[model samples]
Target chain A: MDQFDSVVQLLDSNGSVVANSQFTSTLSQSELLGFYRDMVLVRTLDEQATALQRQGELGLWAPLLGQEAAQIGSARAMQKQDFAFSTYREHGVAWCRGVDPVDMLRFWRGTMHQGWDANHYRDYGYQIIIGAHALHATGYAMGAQLAGRVGSGEAEKDQAVMAYFGDGAMSEGDVNEAFVFAASYQAPVVFFCQNNQWAISEPTRRQSRTPLAQRAVGFGIPGIRVDGNDVIACYEVTEHALHRARSGQGPTLIEAVTYRMGAHTTSDDPTKYQLFSDVELWRERDPIKRLKIYLQTKGILSAELETQLAGEASALAQRMRDECRELPDPKPSSMFDHVYADTDINLEKQRAEVEAILIQSMEN
Target chain B: MAQLSIVHAINQGLRRAMDSDSKILLMGEDIGKLGGVFRVTDGLQKDFGEERVIDSPLAESGIVGTAIGLALYGYRPVVEIQFDGFVFPAFDQIVVQLARMRYRSAGALTLPITIRMPYGGGIGSVEHHSESPEAYFAATPGLRVITCADSNDAYWMIQQAIASDDPVIFLEPKRRYWQKGEVNIEANMSDALNMYSAKVLTQGSDCTVIGYGPTVATCLQAARFAADDGVKLEVIDLRSLSPIDMSTLVESVNKTGRAVLVHEAPGTGGIGGELAARLSQACFYKLEAPVMRVTGYDVPYPPSRIEDDYLPDAERILDAVEKSMNY
Candidate 1:
């Protein structure tokens, strides 16, 4: 109960606001409702993507069923100028960053290498290599500091970076190196970890003896453990961390205690190792249901508002389904298009050779 | 014009690159106050200040990974891995992130990062210090692998590599760092051979010998010895390993009808094999015999006591040349 005992919670599992949290004054009712809508929309997108994978439309799907609050809350807390580097499982964060839902399916559909332009969204696309982008984010933050775009008094002008990884990434050398550089340089970056219990069947405890947040203390970084299922709690912690980073206080490691409610991906069968009781236990702490209960208790979730939110979610899911099904196969020659900034001489030679082979095949 | 060692030439080149572009940065372990393990970045931190010339932590992967980020942020970071063998720790970042980022982003982003490592086996100090890891990098796409054998090329190519938009793996012959030569500071890149082109250091009609990095000097020495034996061996310095100057090599092999590939790295699966295969294919009809290679044996770099035998020297190159000429 050391750090987790002090876990910041604005809303509990009972759908009642904790008497002491400051979000009651900071967040407006409309903003609270927006969080609920985003969670529902992202969850719907996740479900639709899973179904599409099952129907052989996608290569695989990594469901974000139980960690919506952690992703959406931190993402919504970010300003447009701030950059985010996320893992492959961060569909909710991508949604909050205003990425088109259909674009998210491009990688799994094998339609494109990356789903979207990182520069356009100010969000680096999902990094498949575990913990590599954590170093990238730290370097970007350091560059921001050196460029005078961060640590300035003006909040809007000071761009910070959020590097999101799972609990499993903590074990990677790149992540540890990122921690060292971020701490030593005091870079304007936040290491956001969604400790969703399992890293494809390996539990968080297997990676660490102490809490994940406590590991940051060894790096001389401030650490915070928050209930990742609590949207307000995640938002508050992330907001405070982002502020600290922008103001030149250095990096903070925030561990969001969450769970994955589905299989690791469409390719995995979690029942082989995970217990049913554990899954049922986390079902009680469903982030979406708890938020809906709070909205209903506050009388802000009217029948018409619920219908509108449900309609919006359905529309998003339908669009994802349609776009995924319509994604065309990439042109064969396009494979050599972007291996380098300028086409390499060898690649150019190979491209011409492949083109000649195709021409011959067509002629034959 | 000044007489400078390959190490000093590189230091001057780094200074010139940073002076020309404020975005150019130098980072590595002990590069700042300690200059570097080889002093290639010596006095750079003093002249440019610490911000531009950084002293990174001991982690090789961190240096490369963060350099990628810095590149994204518009800084052309030139990272140094202290030695050749130590680079494997950063192999993931170099192979996966550095080589694939530009392609993965579909040309939206470019990593103008130059990774400098003192490579090759000659000065046998200990394990990990003496190694030739160029073939691994040459095999990777989206990366440009180049090595400089002389001070003149070292003074210019380091700057050129830093200026390229694509990521460049710049390998320096650690053993030849102190070899001195005349460097014309005012000379432009056009005055020298292009970074990717192979230059014929010595021309002969009897046989063609190809080498890069430290082995280029050995091949030159072998040509000198072969000349004494009345066997004229044409020596070609392969500046770029990947996307090799095959046209030049093919033309030379076509004329000579015999070729010998030389390097300090192991013979099996080495850059020599690639050169041998390409030369064989390109000069199939013109070849007097199969292309031969003189390289280190297929084993881990041995102890310093017998490094002379393990490394390809003038005798080995001449022996391979004699075999090619006889065949």
Candidate 2:
């Protein structure tokens, strides 16, 4: 049996004030509205990408439909220097990292080789291999520790790494290994597992009978769970975790309890495995809608601002359609580049031979 | 200037690499104060300290996966997998992220990570200890696969691997780890023959025998036995697998018109199979006999008692060598 009792929620789902503990926030109306705005914008981008996939504009699409608050709230919670290693579905987090929407789309369209340039956004490319990036994130955090980037006198100066993987990925051996190393090395990083239930037809029950956060305690790292739909709870919890990491308090596992409102990808049919009622039950805790309602109650959202944001979102979606369709296919010859830093003589010969073959075929 | 075994040479190499580069780190299960099962990483933790020579959790994937992070932070990480068979756990990280990172990053990032594994069966070891899994990495792009045949090669090749900007899969012949040889630490043998070039361990104009790692010694010993019957056999040690030392091989096969590949790995889809196909393409016109392979049977590595039958010994290699020349 698992030991740590998951901090089930530091906040409630009803858009009401709940936790007034040390983790409680002191945010004003404008700041709260900004978080909501960011969430809504990222959701708009995700919806646009999904629509593009439906229209055959994307080769692949991993939807984060209901997990917006989990991603956005947590990403917004990170400081500027805090690095991130994310799985492919962290489009919301990528947006928060300031990645160009076009560069991100190019990856979905299968045109560009990589999703985002790390130098451009300071966010690593979307890692496709499941649970593998957790190790990379931990190692980087260890590197940060070695470089004297962590445990600095200044709290704001110290940096932490947030590694994003899902509940499905929690079962991966690498993720578990990462926990051991992170614990042993005292790496300054956060293991963020967005437990959005399904891992491609396999439910959370299939992954673990117990909650995923409880798995962290076995590794000697304290774990927590938050109401993933409640943006405020996610923000507060992620902030606290990041704070712990930066303060040289070692690694923490955050199991964001949420739901995947859409299919795993454009190729999946959720109806085949999951029930409609289960999906419907989670829709009430919609990440975007809860934030919108909260903003409305606080007199934070205006009709004019809403209309303007909607107009901008539609324009962005249309531009994605136009640009994604126009992104050029990578040149066949260019595949030979970047395999090795040097020419390696042998690869160059192979490249020449291939180019000759390609040219001969064209002539034929 | 001192003589050392392949295992000690490797230990010295690690000490030197870490001593030279502050960014260099070593991690594996029992590799710290316990000094690895083979003692290759012995005393490294004590000399370099725990931070540098780390004792990772007993998880191969985590070791390699975390090494990727160390690489990303400009650290040269050398990861030791306890055994070849255990490396499969980390195979996903190697193929998906480590191999493809530079290509995926478009050269903006490089994983100068070296994954060290003790491969090939001979010492009557139990299951899950003896495996020649280098073929998997050789098949995967963005990874350079190499194996050291002797102590001298072990001394220099490891440093070359460390200096390489790409991810390297370094498979050490565990059975030969204790075999002693003179190693000139000052000598730069990296460019001696060539990184990917096959070395002519023994020269013969009649037929060629190709092998790597532990099998090279066996092939050379077999050539000496074959020489008593006046069969002048040419032996080639394939130091690197992925970018095969084709020029030296093609030249030899073209002269001999007959060749045999040997290894402890299986016959089908083995390095021998790939080398045979490439030879067929490069030296087809020169062929007088079909290139044969003396390798372990096409099956999973059997029990330690049966391993002698599974491995390609001197007799098996000479058997193939004689048949090819007879053709």
Candidate 3:
């Protein structure tokens, strides 16, 4: 299929609702406004986090500048029981899942390996290793299938698993293996590949020869490409895929065609590899801006609502800045905790010896 | 009590665990119908049904990676790696994901997963078939690396490892699969010896000869030889590799005043080296001689024809014992 022609779009780049689109007419005004609010809040968080990293408050930060629609849209499509496995850049997804922004900063702020309780948020935290959690999502989906949580006929009872990865992760062995397993087992999972066009210094072309969505077809799963910058398209596509999964139709691959408008991380220099013209072009297709325009055109985004959202975003940013610095350093002995669930005699001795030395040093 | 081979004992142990826990899953390549390459899981798939016993695709990483997910979803998954050398593909998942999940989650997540792989040399198999890669995992902190040396331990420790909240690297001595011993089938799991405690098979005072997995029988034979020479050798099976059971080793060495470690893995950077270091430190004052180790040479596993020379046998253990005795 032609990459451009096959893309499932609900709204065009200029915020005009696409004519004859199957998904555009189904969206509710409240859901649109909620998506707009989520995108704005996470975008604000992204900017503030980047600034914090530059000011030495955080060790590093992965900025989710342009892919707001893809993360927020897909994350908002899930039910309460559905679980999501995400890469580190899914800050918007985490925000939509009710993770406290302060808790999200714990890892980037160097306080802990994991910031939030994964079980609490139904988000499997941030998987640092590339594409590894794809298999985990597939496995969890398989577990859900075995537990009779799929094809239960009740939307409240049936569950699906979402796996979030970037275009760069398309080349990983684990991701391909996950696809094979998910297809073979007919697992209830949706593999969401946010094709943000770049993986650090490498382009999407470096990772795959064809459109990533089409690659899923080889694994016997339906593959769809969507206008990732358009929040309506992302949500509709993700919802459809998740619905199929919950109904025991097996896995679907949704490639959200987007761009990484910012550097890979705080440490990266995008200027070294990407073109300024490319960045300026993607800037026009901004996810939040298009959604805002669509809301404004539909007479849903009033001046009062805009002002309220702006105030909420600023308040959230302020809270994050205050909490990031105030996050306390962990005790030295905390490192020895949670290595194993059982009492290890050798670890106990090491902990005791270290404790004794600390006490002696303090006494001296 | 019934006499059974190590393979049958492990199979029985898996059956028992699966019978009690409805959420227990068995997943691996060819483990379902083929019953594993060594038939350790024979007839399990037919009895447990396909949902509980899965015959996975030929991908080690997929098997382990998916097992981690199953564990996350509140199922106890027992994954089998087809061979020792084939486990490298899944090493990242085993070491990084499975091992560190609990610690990384700060105890919020617990993976009650057991990874069973047959390891060690002596069956005169191909290069990848016979390998002792236990040290690499034993060095990792969040893992419980334990191996069963005989039928009785195989029967009980498989259940114990399955019941553990932490991830366990359950290594089976491949060459000793057919070795038969009487397993106490009616005994309770609570009454059995701790999986981490080293067992003193035979009591002696002159030297503590320690081995685990495939080499435990070799140590016993070496002890018998030492007895013929009028020397009493205390034979101890170092079952748990990660925790090392240092207290048991220390106690035995404290009494024997000499220690000789044995293994099929290379001596350099192996479990033998770690044991020697710890034993020397703990028994510094009580030691009559330096701790000696009889192990494979530092090289890739050789051809099947020359494996006997490469593997640690009774003669080699005796040589190490004599060296400690002469000192």
Per-candidate DockQ values are 0.02, 0.02, 0.02
Error of 2 at B324 (Å): 23
| Model 3 misplaced regions, further than 4 Å | A1-5, A20-22, B1-327
Residues A148-183, model 3: lDDT tens digits: 999999979999999999987787788999999999
The regions of model 2 sitting more than 4 angstroms off are A1-11, A20-22, A361-364, B1-327
lDDT of 1 by residue, A161-216 (tens): 99999987787788999999999999999999999987665567656788889999
Each candidate's lDDT (Cα)?
0.85, 0.81, 0.87
Off by more than 4 A, model 1 = A21-25, B1-327
Cα lDDT for residue B327, candidate 2: 76
TM-score per candidate, in order?
A: 0.57, 0.57, 0.57
Using lDDT as the yardstick, the better of models 1 and 2 is 1
What does candidate 3 score in Cα RMSD to the true structure?
19.1
For candidate 3, chain B by itself scores a TM value of 0.99
